[model samples]
Target: MMTGGLSETKSATPEIQDMVDEVKPQFEKKSNEKYDTFEAIEYKTQVVAGIIYYVKVHLGGDQYVHLKILKPLPHTGEPVELLDYQTGKTKDDEVTYF
Candidate 1:
């Protein structure tokens, strides 16, 4: 699974960096616009039995991405899951572009 990135606390990680790299294009496509750059601001994780259940990333421009790491014990693979994408900049932050 995509097992690295956000920390239990508010900090950045290489895993999250990788996630950002992979998800950026999707975000742009979903938003129907392009961002010259993206800066992840904050993130929180939900864990169960010492394993991460999911991650929510707060990016610059008030964009947000929700990810969940899938499990199956692949011999060699990065297991990353994308649950949803959202643009919190809209009125009331209730709208999801994708």
Candidate 2:
């Protein structure tokens, strides 16, 4: 993949699901909405100083949210952080850099 460019979007995997779980609380807090169902639908990744993940998540039916999460380089011992997010998204919305 090209440096600093987002990778092609891929369907969510188990690893990606775990990452979503890790940051779900932060997302709920930021959005001020508790989701009864949170599932990762797809995602794209950009290589930076660390890694930026742009994920499309399903919040039950007809509801979705896009999350921007940062995973610091392992050597730095930094926690994965929920950087920002966009609410009121839909299944057709493409997950892109924000």
Candidate 3:
């Protein structure tokens, strides 16, 4: 994959799902909505100074959200950050760099 370009979207693996779980609370806080069911469905990755994960999440039923999370380089000793997100997405929505 290109260094600065987004990787092809892929189904969420166990690792990806764990990453989502780590940031779920932050997402809920930012969106001001608690999702009873938060599931990571698919994702795209980009490599910068760190890794940027663009994840498509299922919030049960027809509801969905896109999350942009940053996992700093391991040596930075930084925590993964919930950078931005878009709500009202759907199962059919493509997970992009936004």
- The TM-score of candidate 1 is 0.49
Models 1 onward score TM values of: 0.49, 0.97, 0.97
For model 2, what is the alpha-carbon lDDT of residue 1?
98
Q: Would you list the rank order by TM-score, best first?
A: 3, 2, 1
| Model 2 stretches with alpha carbons more than 4 Å out | none
User: Which lDDT tens digits does candidate 1 get at residues 1-98?
Assistant: 23443334445477666766566676667668776645443345543333342334555454655434333235546445454554444212322112
Clash tally for model 3: 0
Model 2 score (lDDT): 0.95
Worst 10 residues of 1 by lDDT: 89-98
Write down the lDDT that model 3 would get.
Answer: 0.94
- List the candidates ranked by lDDT, beginning with the highest: 2, 3, 1
lDDT of 2 by residue, 1-98 (tens): 99899999999999999999999999989888899899999999999989999999999989999999999999999999999999889999999989
Displacement of residue 13 (Cα, Å) in model 2 is: 0.4
